[model samples]
Target: MSDEPERQIKALTGALMEVYETLRLICLHLPVPIQLPRGPEYDLNTLVPAVSRLIEIIGDQPMREDEQSLVWGSALNWTAAAKLYSRYLLTGGDFVSRLELELLIQTAGEGLIIYLDGPDSTTQE
Candidate 1:
């Protein structure tokens, strides 16, 4: 019983890492001098669904109202990040800029660490 939360957190962390890797790969391979979207068909709309899926995968439990809000906020941040990346790509910015990409990856990795290590109410203090 005591191990359940730990196991769940571990699984969530793994899933997040997988998603982050996919995002990193996309960023790496996105064409240089990106073709900017001219219509609704090729907009950043796709990122919203991805962010929702990520939140669904990482956070599936019922939560207090406040916690639910916080989760939604985090999801929004993820969505915004995706949109920003898309914009950067569309503007012909270097998609594989080493410094920026490294920072993004490092931030995601640190986030995974925090998610894994954060205190769980189910665990003993």
Candidate 2:
């Protein structure tokens, strides 16, 4: 494998870490009553596995454009979903809105896991 995929993984993981830090800041400001879950939908649950697989893929081969895009898109989704959840929580939303936030978190997590098993894999695995 070339250094290109290594470089790409570094860049992608850096962007992902920025998103993670931003979300952590958001969490710090969330209402005291609204503790984020340590459950399956936790951001790290999405981030850790994805980053691990990305590292493996970088070590094994180059990334296709579609795979790169999916990873980047998932980072954005994680950011958007977290922000929306935080905003809704801070604004005193209803239970239905809370449920919607849960769905957003879950969906963003699903998006992040698209490459969890490697370059040719899907979330279905």
Candidate 3:
């Protein structure tokens, strides 16, 4: 039998790399220089949110390929969640990251991606 876990890891890594590259390029354009009071220990926590904000922008921005325009509804795609979870493992302490990962898995399994905004036309700060 095939090793399902290994397969999942591979797929998720591929997707993450793709999304990460795209976001990394966008991060280069962030107007504000990020400054942290602490050190590398907080890099993951601080950088992750910055990246999350970029993800939101990416979801709204359209990509053009082969004369087609494609937009991501959210970064929480099923395969992407695995990458995020693995990141959470490496990032160390963070309860919010853990919850987001679980919710991503649950929603992805249901064939849906959750956005940062509420259904009632409000946004989350």
Candidate 4:
């Protein structure tokens, strides 16, 4: 039981980390700075497309119906990751800090909450 939750958490964390790494790689290839937002006006216009392409590259095989969900889900996960990454960079945290990793994992959990709750549900709001 406890192990089940732990394993699930680990799996989700790994997925988020993978997404983060992929986003980093994609960012490296791009020309923009893609800095973290400073306030509530944080727009995801650039990140959404980059993350969508990354998810497609990473999970587009076999063409399953679930892959569609995965693509969009990864986009959402990357959006959250960008938020935390920006915070880390702005605060002068180390590039690979454990705190940043933990924030990415937590953001992934929030993405899961959004997925499970559906687009219209206000449970997380």
Which predicted model would earn the best lDDT?
A: 4
Residues 1-125 of candidate 4 have per-residue lDDT tens digits of: 65854554455446555555543543343333232223233344555455556555544344434433533464565666656555544565453554555666566555445444544543344
Ranked candidates, highest TM-score first: 2, 1, 3, 4
Q: Model 3 shows how many backbone clashes?
A: 0
lDDT of 2 by residue, 32-101 (tens): 2112333324465555554344333432334455555554455456655445544654575555765565
Error of 3 at 37 (Å): 17
2-116 per-residue lDDT for model 3 (tens digits): 5854555455445444443443443343343222123323234454565445444543433322111111323334335655666765665265765665566555433211221
Each candidate: what lDDT? 0.44, 0.48, 0.42, 0.49
* Deviation from native of the Cα of residue 81 in model 1, angstroms: 1.7
* Weakest ten-residue segment in model 1 by summed lDDT: 31-40
Best by TM-score: 2
**How far out, in Å, is residue 23 in model 1?**
10
RMSD of 1: 16.1
Model 2: what TM-score? 0.43
1-125: candidate 1 lDDT, tens digit per residue:
86864554454334434544444342333232112223223334654575556455434444443333343344545455455455544564353542353344345554434343433632466
- The predictions' CA RMSDs to the true structure, in order, are 16.1, 18.0, 11.6, 13.6
Which candidate model has the greater lDDT, 1 or 4?
4
- As for candidate 1, its clashing pairs are none
